[model samples]
Target: MNFPDLQTERLILNQLNEQDTSALFAIFSDKKVIQYYDIDAYQTESQAQQLIEFFNKRYLENLGIRWAIRLKENGQLIGTCGFNSLNEKMKHAGIGYELAANQWGYGYASEAISKIIELAFSSVSPFCELYRIQGDTMIGNEASEAVLKKLGFKEEGVRRSSGFWKGEFHDLKCFGLIKPEFKAL
Candidate 1:
């Protein structure tokens, strides 16, 4: 079955394609945007092109879903969202995304993530008994922390020096939004 394109008040979430490379590069080349991200900023247009192809292959394998975050008003790609780390663990499938720095506070991330969370637990598969959305965010990313909280994630704790980035070990906030606790979100 095909997943219908998802729309929020100001954004659309859909799969990525070659046509989006330019726009992907536009946001990904900004070093600060990926500062807390695991993937590095694209060094050139070709890197972005390669990333677009990689995204396509992942979908072809049914191994993951990556949706381009587009501005509904202009149909422009501002970011990407969806699940990563799908496996038997059930603990790893998660909602992950990044947006153009300019679009940071407009509710786009939460809107798109909320949809993915709904789909993951309902339309995707084996939703019954699934209890939570486990997530991790770098210690200082207040923006991401806030979004997760808005989505009803509770911070259980933090892992000290769990990630090495920018030449230093960083703490990562651990969070979870379980099914029973998610009703109000």
Candidate 2:
């Protein structure tokens, strides 16, 4: 299937590429942005390049897609949002996202993620048969929790010490949205 580009009122979610390394690096290297990302802040552009390659690989393998979020107004890439894991046999996938510090508090993450959920649930040929999409955030990440809640994801439970980050294990608060829940929205 062809990689799709998702659009919202103020954002365009497109595939990431080499040209996006600098912009992505700028966002990923910021402490505020990566605070709850469960990964260390990038230390160089090469890491961003590696990330883009990883994203492309995932797409090529039909495992997931990580769209580079761009503001339509100025064409500035502000963040990314997409599936990070897929289980076709189980009809579920894991969702992940992060936004630039300057783009926070503007509802961009929610808008972008809502679109991804919409795509996940709609009958769009070979691309939309998922029955559930799950997301997890660091235990104390209230902002992420609020975003997931606003988009109709119900918090399931916490996975104690499930994620290793910052040289320690961190509890993950899991949220899930089933197909029925999404259809009822």
Candidate 3:
């Protein structure tokens, strides 16, 4: 399916156009933001250029989808959020989001993810199996964990040494919401 322009009550979830690359870089550039990410440079304009190229490639490939989050009243780029990982065999995708540190404590993350849950589990036909939504949070990211919980994702398990960040091992919290369980939300 083509990338979509999804809307939530307070945000317009539009596909990342040219104007969003720098804002994307801005979020990644913050060390505080990048600290929990699996692979992030925080930011460098050069890396932003590379990221823009990468997003274009993946979007064309239908392997990923991304949206630039903007306030409905103004189009300022607050952050980019969307699917970043996929597994065809598993018939599931990992949903992710990153926001400017300054934008925290608002309902944006939860609001954005609510739409993703619906999209993931939307079956095209009676014969189509549903897509499951999964997320992994580095064990220390309490804020992320809270967001996932508020969004109705279940804590499936914890992988000991689940992820390696900055060459050091850290447990990663695994989360998921299957199609059957989502409607209850």
TM-score of each: 0.87, 0.96, 0.89
lDDT of 1 by residue, 2-80 (tens): 6447787778888787889888998899987998887778889888888878766766665666789898888999999
Q: Write the per-residue lDDT of candidate 2 for residues 76-141, one digit (tens) a residue.
A: 999999999888889998999999998899999999999988888888824537999999999789
lDDT of each model, Cα atoms only? 0.78, 0.90, 0.77
Residue pairs in clash, model 2: none
Off by over 4 Å in 1: 1-4, 88-92, 123-130
Please report the TM-score between candidate 1 and the true structure. Answer: 0.87
Which candidate model has the greater lDDT, 1 or 2?
Answer: 2
Error of 1 at 159 (Å): 1.4
Pick by TM-score: 1 or 2, better one: 2
Looking at candidate 1, what is the lDDT of residue 162?
90
Better of 1 and 3 by lDDT: 1
Q: Candidate 3: global Cα-lDDT?
A: 0.77
